[model samples]
Target: MPTSILRIDASSRSCGSFSRDIGDVVERSLLAKHPGADITRRDLAQQQIEHIRNETIIGYYTPGEAMTDELKAVTLTSDEIIAEAKSADILLITTPMYNFSIPSALKAWIDQLVRIGRTFDYDGHSFTGLLPGKQAYVVIAYGAGGYSDDGPLAGADFAKPYLSFLLGFLGIQDVTFVPVEATTADPATVACEVEKARQNVRSSLDAG
Candidate 1:
């Protein structure tokens, strides 16, 4: 069977977005490895996933046999989102840092995916993620420099750490990051950063 890849784009910009361009590099590299891979692209900016609501929360706790039609209608989006995630072998997420963390749309999507009795389970004491044996490649674009681990402003980078933890919570332990930093720098520097991100994608895919 062919590999299944879920590509999620969280960048608000429709064109000339660093994160999207880097994502293209990742998609191409993956295709080179798995020519007939099934690719599912979800553009959060265009689709605009709604934030979870009270009805959705109620649906989560309600047992399947006890769920009402109203609750089911409200929770259908979450069900679809979780189904897509469950069907993927690899996840490719591309997002530019927004206020030192992930975009609101991406966060909303995460909230929908991390549900009890679906993606994860808690046995009164311990928690186990239902979705395992999957890998993730996250491409993060930063407007300014110094957010890398060795950079001076590394302490302020909440995006990377948050994503790392979130993916692990969902049982995706094999996660790689491709950083595109200093995008607000001069034209030459921006080009260099983009090229570096491309090379990083290639190298990570090669290693994988």
Candidate 2:
């Protein structure tokens, strides 16, 4: 059981967001296993998180001690986001597939958290991730395809592979994907998929 949890929701729709609802379930399940675990939530749908800009990139390279006020201001949010994840034993993230990939807000968060020297490092020849021993679960709400590895149009589904790669880059090897597919499909299909996602969440906790 984890002592701390980081929950992030990146769905655009707040009212009819199926991903957010499932994400809440994921959080609750984690909490049940680790009762009273400290949870830090970042709802990108309700907040305005700016995408990575050139100033941010420049600031990331600057040392903290030597960083100018301008650089610090630009990178503060990213630094805080990274710190939150670094403090968590587990991360629960849910993102609705936007045009076959993750939402822009989520991607921006990744850009900030996946820092070069902070979260990872390149030693001349090889790059090594610094954050380790942390687990992550990502809930994918897709309109079509991207659910199964052998499913049709697998190439079209970019969320899973991209997320897997990025999280792995950050030294998070234990990652779970609980996908609720076909949200734009019929109600029965949506319900079935939602149930599958919930079962997957339960199985993850049970296995843990």
Candidate 3:
């Protein structure tokens, strides 16, 4: 069981977000299993994160102790963001399909976590991840396309493929996808997707 959870919400909508609903279910299930689990929430809709600035990049490249005061200020936000993720045992990333991709805010958050020198190490020939031993659940909400492994638009999904790649790049191989798709279709179709997601969540928790 995860002793700490980092819940990152990328949905633009706050009230009726399907991804957030799925995250809520997952968080509740986890809480049931690990009763005092600590939850750290980063709601992108509420938190404003800018894209990686040139100054921040320079600051991040410089050693933290050696960086100047100006550079330290530039990289402080991203530093804090990385620290949060580094402390978590599980990450629940709920992202809605924004133009067939993630929201800009979520992208910014990812940029912060994928910093050089902090989350990875280059051994000349290749790189090794510094953040491992954690699991991730990606809950993607879509209006029409069903992008699961067996869905008709299976190979058409760029979100899941990209997210999986990002996780692997960070040495996070134990990842699960909970897709809630075809929301603009009939009620039956949406319900079917929700049921499938619920089942997947249960199975994931059980297997873990």
Candidate 4:
């Protein structure tokens, strides 16, 4: 079946963002596999997201007219974000690791998408992720050396784990990570790693 892929690029940098570049390569492969697939792109650098505030939280719980204008602008984007996410069969998140974690703008987007009783719900006993039938692919780029889920840097680095947690929280169990590590390594090494990631994406596309 044809799929709709939502491509979100969270890199603040210019075209030099290796993560975005790898994501483009993977998207191209996906398009090749599913010729009728539709792609929607969102550049977080171009359209920045406002941080969630106390007013925003209050607005989220209050009535429409009761919310101040500023609070409405801050907290009322959940419907739009949720609608877009719900429409997509696949989500492609491309983000460079900034200070060992996701960009603030991306986090803001996440906060908006994760509305209580919407994306997930917490009963008296436990939390339940409401979003289902969604798959996610994360492309992560880092300037330092390799950092996997099991290493000295594992707990310290919040990029991969945070992405995994967020997607998993949304009930997206079919999630994959394509990490293009050591971008700050030697030029040759970086180039080789990029090629490897591109190849991995190609293989994934072919398999799918």
The order of the candidates by TM-score, greatest first, is 1, 2, 3, 4
Model 2 residue 169 distance off true place after TM-score fit, in angstroms: 0.4
Candidate 4: give its CA RMSD in angstroms: 2.3
Q: Rank the models by lDDT, top first.
A: 1, 2, 3, 4
Across 58-151, the per-residue lDDT of candidate 2 in tens digits comes to: 9988987899999999999889998998899999999998988899989888888989888999999987887899999898888874468677
Candidate 1 lDDT over 1-208, as tens digits, reads 8999999999999898999999998989989988899999899999989899999999999999999999999999999999999999999999999999999999999998999999999999988888899989999999999888689879889999999988998889999999999999999999898888888887889666
Q: In order, how many clashes per candidate?
A: 0, 0, 0, 0
- Candidate 1 displacement at residue 80 in angstroms: 0.4
| Model 2 alpha-carbon miss at residue 88, Å | 0.9
Q: Residue 61 lDDT in model 2?
A: 89
Give the clashing pairs for model 2: none
> 38-155, model 3: which lDDT tens digit per residue?
9999999998788888898898789767999999888888889999989999988999877777888889999888988889888789988788999898999988765766778777
Give me the overall lDDT of model 3.
Answer: 0.86
Could you give candidate 4's per-residue lDDT for residues 1-208 as a string of tens digits? 5799998899998678999898988888778877899888778899886777787677667776676778767666766787778889999999989998999989988988887767888888987887888988899998876587475666667898888988988889888899888898999999898888888887777677
Q: Flag the better candidate by lDDT, 1 or 3.
A: 1
For each candidate in the order shown, give its overall lDDT on alpha carbons. 0.93, 0.87, 0.86, 0.84
Worst 10 residues of 3 by lDDT: 145-154
User: Over all chains combined, what TM-score does candidate 3 have?
Assistant: 0.94
Return the lDDT, model 4, position 18.
93
Task: Give per-model CA RMSD.
Answer: 1.0, 1.6, 1.7, 2.3
TM-scores of the candidates in the order shown: 0.97, 0.94, 0.94, 0.90
CA RMSD (A), model 3: 1.7
- For candidate 4, what is the lDDT? 0.84
- Candidate 4: segments with Cα more than 4 A from true spot: 63-74, 149-152
